[model samples]
Target: MPPVSSPGLLDGTGALRTSVEERAARVRFRRAMALMVMTLLAPGSAQLVAGNRRVGLVAFCLWLGLLVTGFVALVVALVVALVHREWIFSMVSNPSLLLVLRLGLIAAAVGWAALFMDAWRIGQPLSLRLTHRRAVVGVNGFLCLSVMGTLLFGAHVVGVARDGILTMFGSDEVVGAHDGRFNVLLLGGDSGEGRWGLRPDSLTVASIDAETGRTVLIGLPRNMSSFPFRDGSPMAEEFPDGFDCDGCYLNGVSTWAQDHEELFPGSEDPGVEATIAAVEGITDLEINYWAMVNLEGFKDLVDAVGGVTLNVRQPIPVGLPHEAHFHYIDAGVRKLDGHDTLWYARAREGSDDYSRMARQKCVMNAMLQQVSPQVVVRNFEKIAQASTAMVSTNLPASELDTFMDLALKARGQKVSTLSLVPPMIQTADPDIPLVHRKVEQAIEQAEGGGTKAAGGTGRKPKATPDAVTGGSIGSLSEGYAANQAEDLGAAC
Candidate 1:
């Protein structure tokens, strides 16, 4: 009508309009994607730019407060670590602080997830084209899941750590170091069926320097007899002269205490108390705490740490000599599994108790040196489970941090060993005064940065023509090198 308008022209104009709409939709899609990314980087940033200023201000302020607090805390922690490291350890070891941290992490995770959802709302996804809306939904969903999943996982790990701390270290009674050292009684308890109550098959005193963390492992054979008890203790009152009776030995102290439970009135574990008394009497070193390791469960702990490496000088039998289904661990410098390692430490076939004792020391030293912090962190859950079943201790929970610090220090230093075996002192009838003297000297040497001669405290026994016996390098008569070595690593 007005100059006869062409249908082609009208169609071209409509196509141009359609193109403009498509461009707008593309812009909306990119805006939505940007909002989600902003939230990922900074939780409330999208709302501040696009919508809900009040809510955005509150969330942003809270986020900023948290960031500032975390940064300040980190700075303080670094300073404390340099100046007063124990303070940091004490804070971490506190059950109350751990619980608070667990709850705070959970709260942070929830709050952050909510902020991600809010950011998606601020992006105005509903106003975009159908394809753009779907894309925005996918991106927002991914951001929420990834961020929330990471936070939730962190919270779970913290929870596990808190539970483990509570389960393993429940004691509240704290004991101080004695004579510039902390002497801990390490008892190897055998409590399987057909065995007399929970008797200690292996006994050792870990005398650690309070400041330096230099340690001396004092091995007391389970077969030791005629040892006195701590003065004024229940066992001491019963046997004033000494624990000298028919069929009596150091390991039997626990069984004897259990038989006469009334002797230890109000005591939760009479066996441990009696054993502590015996250790104190024998070594003349005050006992700060005791840890009883379940020998059967010990294998589980070894497995948890992914086994241990050892120098097996000879074939070690897997089971009792008389057992029909027994095997031997071949001699080599090998990484052995839990089953073989347990047998390696406990085997008695063709080996005397002294040789077995030496093997145990080697195992102890290897574990101390090889099981680093990274190994513990990687296998944390498995180790926590195994430790609960394997060990029972009377050490206070508060002292855990102190010992952890000391353990780290001890790893770099050589471990000295003093065993009351063969040439040093007869197990059947030990020299109590001489035992005390040897213990004191060992501690003195450890502090003085010197170690006893390779053979041990006293005169060395005549070695047999054969050097290798059992799994150790030295014969039983001459005393295994690991049993009484200045540097346990070198001897093993």
Candidate 2:
């Protein structure tokens, strides 16, 4: 009161007001930063340009480092589990118990958040200053870093979510094959079985040659008919005994299995094996192995790879009924995640099952290309985990490690994907017909010199078709060339 010359000078209310404003500004800044991080991380990359790139770039690097470290830790745990043959969840379910460790991690995260908050404030001055080019650059750089960091963090989290230290396969069971060429029939079963609410949407047989590292895929259309399962009684045994065929339709196979579960429970081997036999019969290629997976598994696999990059011949649209109906796709190359991938593989719009098979082959190629040594090394745990429910492979768990090692060596190799359909081979009707002779010829070609008779001009036709379709041997090769043949020999 004695020195109350100016209330503004001596009164603590002015100071208190300033403090309150600062606190409010900080709170606002922190919220904005948090929101920005969340936005940049979720499902898209547009947030990269939200602020200055310098800060963004720094954040991106730090996030990447964290991802690498996390991946390595996960990988080591997986390796241990693989060697020991343990469950992956053994590592995933536990949160470290040490309070000090948890507290330290929280501190680190808070400190990191604080630093970003300060950077954000620095980029925005409140002096009524005009926005300058440097300010804009700073803001953009910061945003770029944030966005990239967010993406990297997201990637890491996805990886962690998909993998763990304990493996589904035990150490005593994980084995690898050397110099062994294996054929895996990949079935994308969608039948409303188990947790995944659909039947097999796509079925592909992949042949991996360990020696040359060459992979060959043969896609089977769900509608293609032939090689009925030993029952002359009628192929539609699944549906009230004659719902469809002497030679079962692709979908009928699953139905038959469901109907006959009482006869064959604890295993759907006979039905799947029958399908394998049908494809083998059609292609004239022996199936060395098989892997049965579903659409959900396929989604998880695509996601595990961090989204595969494919050169889409068309922009496949959404909301189409999941069936054999034809659909249209806009031509272009793009990266697709799980959701888009399902649509892409199932898009038979404006076309037939043949076209759908082609798209499936494209997806397979993209997967092969995207899966690298680095990717495998980083995602081995994830690969195994995601593969658990989705895959039913004949390769024994004991040999899985060997297979992985050999597969790692074969990364980036070219894969030849083919399908049986019109042009290369034709059906009695556009929808159904089984290839008996033509398929034999194609199998011979796939085996070795079988190609000479059916392929090389030097050799004559292996065996003439009983009924020639307009001077062409209604062969599987013809079917593949006509409906399939997109980017035939490009390496991923």
Candidate 3:
């Protein structure tokens, strides 16, 4: 019966038909998977419809000029973030425009992975079907390794943000904001191996305000002593009538300006410019910038932002009690880490540097209300590698997008604090006109005025059930409501 099948290899319900070179190798294996999906969607449209139209019009005009320059730089960074928002933070803190955007994202990730391997060699794939040339070489090696591994991981996160903004803002001057408020200072220092160089054991200023970022903070009292110096300042011609020489305090004015570096001649950090002229003569206020920090790399910037929720209200002691491995960061409202929040903002045995300056203003208001901006963009490269080995600053990288837009507008207001220490001001003779009239009435009640600022002495002291003291609940001679607060998170 099968011997009767030869009408041009039988058709109408017979067998043996597909022949012209096996139907042109199944239409060249479906045009090699439609030219690797048109070069994974228009990357020089599979070499302008099948290879070399002048190298597909120069890689389709550089991929349509990088998608019209990334949609005109996202519409000029959203119209310069609504007209002049610090010129888009001075063009992304320009380190020569982040080294030309990290060499144009590694030359657009090796020219879009060599145009997806030249659209898989114009999809000829040796006339297909060796399992369709191993499925077009596994879909052109997965679209050239997922578009060159997402532009080489965005050029390694823009070369680690231009080497962490040239290692934490190497300053190029820029000072600005003064009366409308900026202040700064901060400190904390405590260097190592036979100390000498940096001694500031925490000072604090952080004024802020410029336009309603209303901060305040103040604090100062590394055993503050007679202060003065800002007028004709070289530590005011060598402490005119103040830094009271007897192991003079306010953090030993940066080891007495690095032990007299010829009275700061062409100063390159004459001990942080003599501790910013003794914190602008003990807060008569002008300073503008300072920073310092380094408290043993501040516990790797508090374990790189993953550990800071305070309210311990008791058991907080970690080391110094003749430390033979002394511990105890017990009490409640937990989340400590970073060696127990740096020994609960530096625990002093039975705590009293004004209850460790009211537990360092409840750890700077719990790291400015739990470090938000999505925990700084999801732990931004481990908080820029623990802030370049824990901070140091002149504060300039063109004012880090104006203090990151005044720390996101002072995390929705209400910070205010004062703490010169003691029953209102006398860290051994620190009543410098009552610490500059409680720092101009806590910057006139944080700019709006009248809320009984400077730790509102409008009486409200009673609540002391657990009576903790050193770890701080009250009693360092009745003060630590976060040192002085109008609302330092409801006085911690």
Number of the predicted model whose lDDT against the real structure is largest: 1
Instruction: Give the per-residue lDDT of model 2 (tens digit) for 219-283.
Output: 66676554333332223243332224566566556566655656554553556655655555455
C-alpha displacement of 266 in model 2, angstroms?
Answer: 7.2
Tell me the TM-score of each prediction against the true structure.
Answer: 0.88, 0.51, 0.39
Worst 10 residues of 2 by lDDT: 467-476
Report the backbone clash tally of model 3.
0
- Order of candidate numbers by TM-score, starting with the best: 1, 2, 3
Selected candidate, larger lDDT, 1 vs 2: 1
Q: What local lDDT score does residue 187 receive in model 1, on the 0 to 100 scale? A: 89
| lDDT ranking of the models | 1, 3, 2
Residue 282 local lDDT, model 2: 50
What does candidate 1's lDDT look like per residue over 235-300, in tens digits?
999999898999999989998998899999999889889999998999999999888888888888
Model 3 scores a C-alpha lDDT of 0.79
Q: How many residue-pair clashes does candidate 1 contain?
A: 0
TM-score head-to-head 1 vs 3, winner? 1
Candidate 3 global TM-score = 0.39
